[model samples]
Target: MEKLLEILNDIQPDADYETCTTLIDDEVLDSFAILSIVGELEEAFDIEITPVDIVPENFNSAQALWDMVQRLQEA
Candidate 1:
């Protein structure tokens, strides 16, 4: 989870999960940020993020993103 948190922190250092969740829920994440996160996750974890996996809930928080990465790697 530390790695996930680190990745998220690199993206938005001042953000907490609560803030990130709200940003996702409110459609405040621009396309560039979303793509940047996707790229970072793929490179960091060596996991493929398909279109089907690109859900707001999945990227809403560091924990949620970690769970998704674990699930994907497990699969």
Candidate 2:
């Protein structure tokens, strides 16, 4: 979670990641930011975020992203 926060902060320092629940819907993260986050997440978590996994529900918030990462790890 700390590492996720770090990456998110690097991408968008102004947004409150800890409590944000509408990252995508609120337009908090644009295409470039999302792509950057995808790269960072893939490298940091040692996971591959394929096109199928790039959904708004999966990137809604920090907890959602963490949940997706954990699910992918388990798989």
lDDT to native, each model: 0.78, 0.93
* lDDT (Cα, tens digit) per residue for candidate 2, span 4-69: 999999999999898999999999999999999999999999999999999999998999999988
Q: What C-alpha lDDT does candidate 2 achieve relative to the native structure?
A: 0.93
Give the top-scoring candidate (lDDT): 2
Q: Model 1: per-residue lDDT, tens digit, 1-75?
A: 777777767876667754365657765566777788889989999999999998888877667788899998998
Tell me how many residue pairs clash in candidate 2. 0
Please state the error at residue 30 of candidate 2 in Å: 0.3
Off by over 4 Å in 1: 18-20
Poorest lDDT segment (10 consecutive residues) of candidate 2:
66-75
Candidate 2: give the clashing pairs. Answer: none
Which candidate has the top score in TM-score? 2
Tell me the TM-score of model 1: 0.82
